[model samples]
Every structure is written in C-alpha cells, then in structure tokens.
Target chain A: MDEIIRINHITKEFRVPDRHEGLRGSIRDLFSRSYHTVHAVDDISISIAQGEIVGYLGPNGAGKSTTIKMMAGVLEPTSGEILVNGCVPYKNRTRNAQNIGVVFGQRSQLWWALPLVESFRLLKDIYQITDAQYDEMLALYRSLVDIEPLLHKPVRQMSLGQRTLSDILAAFLHDPKIVFLDEPTIGLDVSMKAKIRTLIHELNRRKNTTVILTTHDMGDVDALCRRIVIIDKGKMLYDNDIEHLKKFFGAYRTLKLRVKGDLSEQAKRIAAELPECSVSANENWISVLVNEDKQKVISVLSQLQKSYDIRDMQLEEISSEDVIKRIYEGGVV
Target chain B: MKRKGFRFYLRIYFKILAQDLKSKMSYRADFIISTVGMIFTNIAGFVSFWIMFRNFPSISGYSYHEMLFLYGFSLLSVTPTQCMLDNNWNLRQQVYSGDFIKYCFRPINLFFYYESEIFDAKGLGQLAFGIGTLVYAWAKLGLAVTPLAVLKLLVFLAGASFVMAALQTAAAASCFWIENSFYVLDLAFRFRDYAKYPITIFSPVFRFIFTYIIPIAFIAYYPGMMVLRPSEVSLLSWLSPLIGAVFFYLAYRFWMYGASKFNSTGS
Candidate 1:
C-alpha cells in the first residue's frame, strides 16, 4: 500500500517536421520547413503502490509506449511531474534504473549470441547486485520455472516465447521495486502467456515488486492485473479494478450458438426475431449480444430456437475484453 | 544507485567486452574472413603508398620509409577507436530502429553501454598490420630501441587513440539530432587520412585545423616527429596526452548533450 510511483499531470509533446509529399513539395519544404506538435501523452496522472500489478491498457498509437517511456526515464515529460522511488525518473535516470526494470517487447535485452545466463551475469555486474541476492533470485526462478535447460542456450536460438520469458526474468533479477513491461505477452501463445503471467504474479507476490504492464491481450490483464488503467488518444479514460469495469457493462450477455446450418441465415433470423440483440457470425458460431436488463437471455434464446434448428447454445457474461472493446468503439468512458 | 568508482566501471567494461568478443567468435568463418579482409584493406592502402613511392620516392621532402613510419603510427593510434568504438558507426541505424532505447534501460553510463556492446575483431587486423609496419620501419630507419622510448611511444599511442575515439564518438552522437550522423563521422574519418603524412606537407591553415580544431595531427604527425626528428619537435607536440584528455572530455560532454536531446523513434 506504500506509494512507489506518483505521476502528476504528466504531459509529453513532440514537435515533428511537417514533411511534404511530392518532389516539388519536398523542395519547397526544404526552403521553408514547417512543423507540427503531437501530444503523445496528454495531462495524465496516476499513483501506483508497491506490490501491485496494474494493467496499462491502450490501443495501438494510443500513447501507451510514450507513457511507459516517460515512466521508465527514457523520456522526460514536457509538463507536470513524475516521481518514482522518490526521484524524478528523467532527472535521476541511473538511480531510478537501479530500482526499476524494463522489458520492451519485440526487443531482446539479452545478448543475441551469448547464453541466457551471460546476459544475466552482465546485468548483475551492471546493477552491482550482490552474490547472495543473485543466487537467491536464481533459486526462486528455478523453482518457479524450468529454466535450467535454457541457462546455457544462446538467446539467438530461443523461440520468441523463451526470449520473452527470459527478458521478464532478467527484469526482475535485480529485484527492482518496479518493473515496466510494455506488451510482454504481445506475440506469445496461450501456454507461454500463462507461464509468463504466473512468473510475473509469483515474482510480484514474493519480492513485493510493483508491475506496470501495457498489453492489448485481455487474457493478460485478466490473469495478472487486479487493477486496470485504460487510455485512448493520449488521454486516461478509465482507471479501476477489473471487477468494477465489468460491472459497468453488466447488462449485456453474449449468447453463443454452435449452429450446423447456414450461419448467416440463422444469424439474420436471430437478429430479425430479436430486434434488441446485436448479432455477429464467425465460421460456424453465431454470437448474439443480449441486454439482460432489457430482456432475459432465456427469453431471447427460446425465441430464436423456435424459428431455427439451433444445434446448441450457451450464454457468457461480458468480459473485460467486451468492456474495452465497447470503450474503444466509443461506448462510454 | 550511487555512482561507483572508476575501477568498478573498468571491470564491467572488460567483462562486457569479453562477452561481446565471445559472441563475435560464434561465427568463426565470418570472424576470420572479416579480420583477414580488414588486414588486406590496410595492405591495399600501404600498396598505394608503395606505388607512389616507387614513382617519386617522396612527395613532400619525406622519404618512403619515413612515410611508412607515419602511416604505421597513424594505424596504431586509431586501432583503439576502431576496435572499441566500432558500435558508434551503427548509432544512426539503431536510433532509427528504436534499438538505442536499450541503453537507457541499463543502470550504466549510456555512452559506455553503447560502446561496450561490441568489440570489432577487424581492429586486431589493423593492430597486426600497424605493428608489422612499425617494426619494419623501425629497423629500416635505424631508430633507437630504448625501453624509455618504447614506453613513451605507448603513452603517445594511448593519447592519440583517445583523441580519435573522442572525435568519432562526438560525431556519432550527433545522430540523436541529425538524420544521418554517419556522414558527419565520415567527414571526420577523411581527416584521418591527413594524419598518415607529415603535417609539414599541408598549408598552415590545414595544419592549424588539424592541430587545434580536430587535433588529428597529434595522432601520428606530431608524435611521429617526436620519434623521427626529436630535435625539430616543439613543446606543443609533447602535449598529445593533455590534448587527448581535453578532447575526450569535450566529446563526452557533447555526447551527453545529444543523449539528453534524443527523441526516440516510434515503437
């Protein structure tokens, strides 16, 4: 519950040269170059505490990376203040870096051609980590995951999942007070994602390490984060626990049907019969959204069954993914 | 974290350099071929000097063998920069690709981390060729082989290498602001060719720029003078170590400025 990160009205703006299109435009631009400002991160503020895994959620080009970069001391905010571990991140980057770890997905921090442990040793030296701390962390890692087989495997040969897992472990090796993971599970498989999520959860629990993860995968958020902060167009839209966010969209129920016949026709019939429900089809499943408050899901399902020979049907509650999708689609803040 | 002492960083530097060398050795054939190719490249430069000497024996009041000494000294002085700081040559590409942000994540000096990422094996070839030429020139010119003289040569080589590394680092750091700083580094490297000959051959203005502005003349020209013509050498020529330290400090400051102003590329 102790405050470890305090961001107050932080804003990061970038001035980019206005480039011209054609050769003549380019030549004209060379003579009188113009520029425009991009508000990559608008005035946003959030306070994070120790031992909390908060999901920093945003769409592509939604300034997720820009915000994470500012928090990591990679970029200085243009306005307002940010204090991590009682120091301004950009002002005291090296000192802040000692207490924080970062994993920028799609970019491996490990030595490309060296064994995984070599990068770890170099990091140990870089962080000036004591031998006891290093060995203890190693022991914890070995217990949680089967990384012994990977200790000597070169980073270049590892699959994407292995590399990402190693990167996450490396970030936590220093026992940093906070770790910023930008899309850590971005391109990982379900099992790999589960493995990484478990690792992050265990580390946060055991070491009391704060975790700030930016990811589009709702599964990642659902599995690891208790609190979720959603941003769009450089603005913070929502910040609360996942349960509260789900409560906001509690009126809707997803009715999934495993149909054997014409999916589109069945979808059309369902939509026509139930004017209040929103319907969509993919492959052999027709998913119809029913507002439970407006009409019970049972009534909607029974009504559709009378018209079409629905092979099978089931109902699902609105997930965090649905809430986020609705928010991104301009539903509500 | 509090800043550690010099010895701590020095230890990390060698550790990372060893790791880098081990990684480079993974592609054994590529390493061997590139190292050999690097030596051949220097040999090709020497062969050009040989052909020119064959025609005129000397171009600027210096004999063929003396120019060899100058060329050998220039190569030896630059080996440190070539071998250690070769990663800077890729700074522009890394910046464009957003790979430069990797340095920001580490709890180490950005410039040191960037430079320590690689140790160019090709510099070994340059070192081998430079030593070979220096020994050959030493025997031919009948220069004294005193222990003090050898020690002094090493001190001068260290200073000259620092100057060259400083210049290259400063040029490469400009990539943080400019679109392509390799062009600026290339321009700096063109001045390196001037160090292969005596500063006396150039006009006074060129001599001034090489000595004052760029200070590349200290790399080989002035230091060569101290070894070849000790009586003719002035007091200024002996300031290679001081000049190197000053230029390195300035360049490091310049690099820090660029790093502060760096606008990382989009993710």
Candidate 2:
C-alpha cells in the first residue's frame, strides 16, 4: 500500500473574540476588544496509507472535525504541514480537491430541490468524468444497493437516511483517491446504519479508495474500520487496530448488574470495594470493567453480593465502546 | 488530464443552470407567483415614473422618455446579477452553517461554483420588463436601432452587469470575516436605487461618490447618458465598461482574500 497522506505536527488555532457578559462589559469590550486562541488540533501527526478505512473517532468537540477539515482542504492548519497525495491541501486546494471528496454530515452536498440524479450529473461535469465512467459507477451503485427506486426522487423529499446514502454515493461518483466522511452514520437507525456501513465497506474493497471517517458510533467503527484513531481535547490519545485497542485494557470483562439502590451510589461503592475495576452507572445498569489478572470475576461478584442486592447480572468481554469510554473518561488509555 | 478553459466551464455552467431551473420549476406555484410578483413590482415602479412625468414635463434636463430609459437601463444592468448571483445573498447563512464547504470540495473555481449554485427565474421577469420599457422609451425618443447603437448598448449592459455582480460578490465575501454580512450587502442593494435617477440633480460630492466611490453611475446613469446624450456625455461615460471590468477584478480579488481568511465554522 502507498502512503497517500502525510500530516506532520499539524495544529490549527482559532482566535475568537472574548465576548463580555452584559451591557457595561460589552461597552468596555468594544473599547478594549480582546481575543483568545483555541487550539482545535494540536501537534497531531498521522500518516495514512492508500486503500485503508481508518475510523477517526473522538468525543463531541474533540478536534476530529478540525483534522478532517484540514485534510479536506477546507481550512489551513495554523502551524505545521499536511500533504495529501503529494500536494499540500490548503495551499493547492483546487489540485487537492481533484483527488478528494468530502461529505459533511450535517449538510447535504446534493442539490436540495433537484432529483438525486441531477446532482450526480452535475458532479460528472464538474469532475469531467467520462460518460463510460459515469455509467459504470451508476451500474455499480445499482448493483450494490436498490438505488433505482430513489434515483428520480428529489433530495428534499427523501428521508435523512436516504439523503445520507445518496450523498455517500455522490462523493464516490468521481472516483477520487480519498473520501472524508464526517459523522456519516450520525442520527441513523440501526438498519440504515448497517446499510451505509456495508456500502462504504463494499466501495472501499472494490475501489481501494482511502476512507477517513469521523464517527461517534462505535458500531460503525466495528463494522468498517480495520484501524482507529482516537483524539480528545486537541490531542491524539490512541492510534492502532481494533484488537490492539481492546487488548490495551488487558483481560478485562464487563460485569453488568441491576442493583436495588441509586445507580451512582452503587457504582461508587463497587468502585471503592473493587479498587482495581472501573465502574460506571447508566440508568439501572451498573457496569464494571473487571480485570481478571487483578481479581477473579466470581470473587468480585460474591463481594458485591455480600453488601448489595444484585437482582440480575451478566458477564461479558470488554467491548470497543468500553475501551473508548475508558479512554474518554481519562481512565486506562 | 484536466479539462481547462471557457468551453469546459460553459458546458458545466449550462448543466448546473439546468439543474437549478429544474429544481425551481418543481414548485410551479412559487415560480409563477414570484415571477409575476416581480413583473408587477416593476410595473408599479413604472407607474410612479408615469405619475412624476405627467405632473412635470421633465424633472431635470431629461424628458419623460429619457427617465424611462435611465430606469430601464438600471433594470437591465441589475437583471444579470439577480439571475445568476442569488446564491451570494445566502452566502452568510451558508458559511455560518458550515454548508459553504460544498464549494471548497469541488475541483472548479470557488466563485464559479458559487455562481452555478442557482439561477433565479424571477430575474427573467425583470429582464422582460426592462426590455419592454427600453423599447417603448427608445421609440418615444425616436432613437434609431442601428448596429452601432445596438453594439454600444450591448457593451454598456455587459459592463453594468459585471459591476452589479461584482458589488454583490464583494459584499457577500465579507461573510468569511464577519458573522452576519447582510447589513453590508444591504447597503450595496440600497445604492442600486441611486442609479435610476440623474446624478446631475444631486450635489457634486454625492455625484462623485456615486461615480467614483461606489461606481453606481456606471451601472445605469453613465450608460444612460452615453445613449441619450452622447454629445453631452463626459469621457468617463465611454469608460463605463473599463470601470466595470476593473471593479469586478478588484471584487474578485477581495473575494479570494476573504476566502483565504476563512476559518470555517466549527462542525
């Protein structure tokens, strides 16, 4: 595989006006205006190979979008360098744009009121794609998905899922070297999510197109990405394959319990008692990441049973979501 | 390997324009209402002119037909911008919402891409109304439609259209710097009203401002003067097309500067 993207210690800083609270403060602010810098992406370097589906994961406001924007040539990094397919993206944006496609999840790139195919045709002309290439892509789309039904449907009338699907297809139509999908599976149902994931995976396999996807859904990461990069607070936290990430929280099994008392209090108690395991509460379910090397699950359960009433419990392996949560919570990275 | 030059862009432009028209035509009622509404608005404006002319033979040195010619030229000049540059009006909203990234993602020029986003059909109504007024006024003034006159008119119209689009683009490009650029663009829109009247009626300072500062004079007033009173028109009137071309180039440069300063809204 070829290294198509090379990011070297890139940092993007935004200077926002320091707004005042009230009338007097605002008046004073106008007299002496102030600005503070926000480091959206700080000293992050990543080298991505061609034909790789890399899940770029982060919590909300976690610099994932800033990184993606830099890659897509939408924003220039305040410091350092970023090269995509041997071109500095922001400097040679038009040239970089020739080799990349971007889909910002919150907005549709499609013509809002036009039929879906019209947008595709417009893209065809913009990309200057040959007729044969356009028809072949259309045939590929039709074969992979039941796209014929939605081809003539106006984009505004289509459901969110349908619109997202169409948008993904549009991004790939030009056969760009890379595609940046920001939250591609956001606000989607399970079935729709599955379909999109499958479509992305199939496209990657068929075309060997590099995919950089920013998503919150761990399910999407599990289904599509072979490797994942996690960032938090403008800093890189983790970057490795899924299995390695899971193994980072070695021999950990999730001990889920439906307790009688307040979930938070119970969680705290369990945390105090176990000492080695990480415990978190959500509604009535209290989940504990119990390390088998440190303590046996049976013993931990028996100890919990002695103090509190455990109505129901289940033992399972640590999931990717838990690993992400642990990293997000600044627990075991 | 990349297609370059005017022909490629022209082909793509027509395709985008077709898509825009197709999308707009879907709402048949809205299309009819807006187009008809525009024509009616122009008619009401014409009625106001008729009332003014009926009360007095001439407001300044110009006759009723000359006033109509000035008004007609203003309308013709503005029609191109109204038709093609409607997307610039919403650029602030698009930028704030981060939807403007769509322009950055395309391989084409950003300004060209923005222009291709939509085609305003309501502008056709204005175009029709403008042509009708100019023809009526021209016949009343007894101005013969010679090839030389038509060629000169074509140049003036093109020049005026470029100026109109340039001003709009320059105003809209401020969205990249400020949060809301509507006020700035509104000022530009208000200045268009000044072009419909004779600048000679106003004070020298204002005349200079309209001519040099904002260049609203070239949009219609100067061109109108060039056509109606070629002997009395100044040398500046002959340079309307040059001024327009230069102004448009400056506006385009400003747009590029603003875009470079663009730190897109956080996603």
Candidate 3:
C-alpha cells in the first residue's frame, strides 16, 4: 500500500511569554509583554504505508504530541508540509478530519453525562455514518471489548478501564482511513492494556487501518508495533523495526529460573562461578543475566539444572525500554 | 454537497446541544440554583428601576413606563445573547483544559463548534422574566401591538443579540493569544450595560464612545428609542439594526483573525 501519512520537514514554533516572578512582577506583566520563541516540533519528516502500526515513541517534551497534533489537524505547523491521505491536514482540516480518527489517551470525544451508546449514536449522526455501517462497527468493537454492558452507563460514571475502552471504540466508530492513538494505555492496568493492544491489532488487520501509536510503555510498543520510531528533543533518533533494534542489543539475555530446592545457595554458587554475569534472587526465584557471546544461556541453565531442579524458567527478550535507554546513554549498543 | 454540508452541521449542532443539556441536568444543584439566581437577578433589576421611577416620574425626556420598556427591551436583547454565547465566556478555560483540541477535529466551522457548545438552562429563566417585564411595561404604556411593530421589535433584538454574541465570541477567541481573557470579557459585557440606559444620561464623550466606537448604544438604546419615543429624531433609531449587523460582521472577522493565531497551548 502507498504512504497514507507523510510529514515533510514540519516545524512548529510557539512564542511563549517569559513572565517574571513575584506579585509585583505579575502585576507588571499585566501591562507589559515579553516573549521567548520555543521550537515545539523541529524539522522532522516521516512516511508510513497503509496498515502499518508505527510506534511513535519519545520521552516527554520531545514534540511527539506536537507532531501528532499536526497530523490530526488540531494544530498548524510554523513551516513545512504534512500530507495525510493526500490532504494537508492544517489547510484542509475538516476534509482531513473526515479521514482520520484521533484519541488522545483518556480524554474523550464521548459526551461525559450521556450513555456510551448515546455518544456513539451522536458520533454516527455527525459523521453521517449509515445504519448498516454503524451496526457493523458497533458489533465488531463489542466483540473485542464487550462494551454492551457499559453501553447504558454514563461515561462519567465508568471506571478508567471502561472509559478508556469506550474511548478507543468511539475513536474507530467512523472507521477513518488513518487513526492516531496517543498514549492509549497510559493509566490502564495490565489486562486493560492487553485488551487495548488486541483491539488495535485486530482493527488494523481487519480494516487495513493505518495506525500511528504514541506510547511511553515499552510493553505496548513490543506488543503492537512492528516498526518503531524513536524521537527525542524534537528530533528523530531512530526509525527501524524491532528486529533491527534487537539485532544490536538482543545478544544479552536474562534467564529467570524458579529452583524448587535451595534457591539462595544455587544463586550464590552461580554468582561466584560466573563473575561477569549478574545474579539476583528472591526466596525461590533466581534471576541470572548472561551474554551469549561470553557465556551461553544454555550452558548457564545446564550448570544450574545439575544441582537444582529447574521447576520453571522464563527467557525474556531484552526490554524495549532498556534498548532505548542504551541507545540514549551510548548510541545504539 | 451544499445540502449535505448544511444538514451535517445542523445535526452536529443539535447533538452537541443535547449533550450540553444532559451534562447541565446531571449537576442538578448547580442547574437549579443558577436558574433561580438568574430569575432573581432580573427581578432585582426591575425593582431597582421601579424605585428609581417611583422617586422621579421622568428622566431625560423619558417617562417611568417608557424607561421600563427600554430596560425590558435591553434585557430581552442581552439575555439570549448571554445564553447563546456562554461558550465564548468559557473558551479561555476550554483552551486551558485542552478541550479546544477536540473541537478542531470536527468537520464543522470553528465558530459553529463554539455555538454548539453553548446551551444555558439559566437563559430560560431570564427569558421568562424578560418577557413578563416587557408585557407589563407595554400594557402600562398602553401601546398597540401592531404587526409592523412586532416585526420591528424582533429585527432589532436579532441585531442586538448578534452584536453582543459577536463581541463576546471575539473576546473569547482573544484568549487563544492572550491565554486569559477574563478582563477582556468582563470589559466587553460590562461595557454593554451602558446600552440599558439612555445615551443622553451620559456625557457627550461617553455617548460618542458607546455610539460610534462600540456601537452598543445602537443595539438596544436607539432601537428602543424608536419604539417608545417616536419623534422625528427617533427616525435615526431605525438605522440601528443595519448598524448592528455591520458591527457584528466586524466582530466575527476579528474572532476569525484571533483563531488563526491559536497555539493549542499545551497537553
């Protein structure tokens, strides 16, 4: 599929007032004006194909939201161009809005005091969605999240999880060609996050939806995004797939072993034997970190298995957070 | 495409209206208290004027009953504008709270979006009180309610409401640039109080500022003058609505200009 969203050298500048401290200065500020220019989104360019779930990751204050707002047509860039589905989002805001679905975390488009279904119906009317299309979309989302029980409940009365679920469903109700999910799982519990991830995955696969997901949670990136884009200080740091990132950092693996008998003695012996490896243990759980180049994971497990019965073991992929942190600290280890 | 566009916006407008009403109704105490407070405010204004007229039979070539009609006309004109433009007053807070961002994604005019955000239940109370005052004053004055007179009243009120709505909306839009527009809106709405009284009561400079610079005096005062006074000089009051329309257009243009500079403040 062709590129559904293309951001070309876009920059957003904000002229913020530099206010002085103290009550006297605040009163003086009422009469005088002083401003400092802030480059909220520096020159950044990106392109995404249809049905691609691109994880737009960044630390806070890195212009991730500025870029998303520009894409979502809620903001205008100071310079350069942005094309979403061949329409300049700022110049053709209403037209671009017709083709885009935007959810800014838990902040919702649903009417707060109305029932969830009432909000959906209002959206249906505003978007001019047909009855058949509305029913199909509602049925499909209901299957994913089971929103039927919550449909009669007012949005203001819902739990955070239920509200976020309803918000995600409302974002896709019109079935826009492209969707922007801004920190969709921010305050959600683990299970709620999993449900949201599943919804995104299913929606993208079934509807060929082009998704741009901005998230701070590494697990969300690991689960839902194949291609990752890391941005910091309003600059693009890296744009590559998970495989490419793992290629450099994935060599080091952590093995979490549950020894049924004598956990600390085995943990001590392993730490003493493998001086290079880091070992930490609880009452029954032993965490053994090993680099494949120095000492293979299989050998470490074999060595541990001889004395201690490995009741259960877990092999963890290097977390996306550590990978990004490593990249930030020492440039793509 | 034209019909579709019109119908689309109209549907969205009512949908937002419905939601606003529901949200207001949910806060039962706030809703009930605000409505009752508005009714009392109009009553106090009427009683204050009644006391003033009771002491002095006339002021500046206007009788007690004529002054009541003038104030009632102003109230009718101002109350609906206050109701319709409630969103404009709240625009500063909306921008601060990031609710303004959602409005940009709608397939509707930005001004239309602001219009839809407004649905004040308190305005119903004000409306009831205003009509009651206007009828009482009209009956006391013993003026005939001719078809032409009724039509004139509506046209002038529409013009007055437009002027008030446009100014308040423009003041709110200024919040996008100024960040806080409490003073600007306060000044705009407070300045409008001059229209409730006769322009002749103020100094020549005040008359010029209100009549020419702001043109609010034309909104209710001059129009009310035409209805109640009806002298040869009162013929000039017939031009109030047209003058109001021009000022309203200018205010809308100012609002759009301010909106173009919006920075979307923060997260």
True contacts kept of each: 0.57, 0.66, 0.43
Q: Which ranges of candidate 1 are over 4 A from the true structure? A: A250-275, A278-288, A296-298, A301-322, A328-333, B146-148, B202-215, B234-240, B264-267
Residue lDDT tens for model 3, A107-167 = 7777778899888888787677889999999788767777778999999899988888888
Better of 1 and 3 by lDDT: 1
Comparing 1 with 3 on TM-score, the higher-scoring candidate is 1
What would the per-residue lDDT of candidate 3 be over residues B175-216, giving only the tens digit for each residue? 877755789888888887677788898899998988777767
Candidate 2 per-residue lDDT, tens place, A1-333, comes to 799999999998888779989999989887998999888898999999999999998878889988887887878888999989998888877778889988889689888888888888888888889999999999999989999878899998999999999999999999999999998888999899999999999999998999999887778888999898988889888888877775667688888999898999889988888788888999969998888888989999898898899899998877655666778776544
Candidate 2 chain A, run of 10 with poorest lDDT: A324-333
Model 2 interface CAPRI class: medium
Each candidate structure's TM-score, on Cα atoms with residue i matched to residue i, is: 0.90, 0.94, 0.86
Ranking by DockQ: 2, 1, 3
Query: What's the TM for model 3?
Result: 0.86
For residues B1-62, write the lDDT of model 1, one tens digit per residue: 44677887899989988988888888899999998889789989999989988999786889
Pairs with steric clashes in candidate 2: none
DockQ of each: 0.56, 0.64, 0.41
True contacts kept of 2: 0.66
Q: Model 1: per-residue lDDT, tens digit, A36-133?
A: 98888899999999999999988788899888888888788989899998999888878888999999898988878889999999999999899999
lDDT of the structure predicted as candidate 3: 0.80
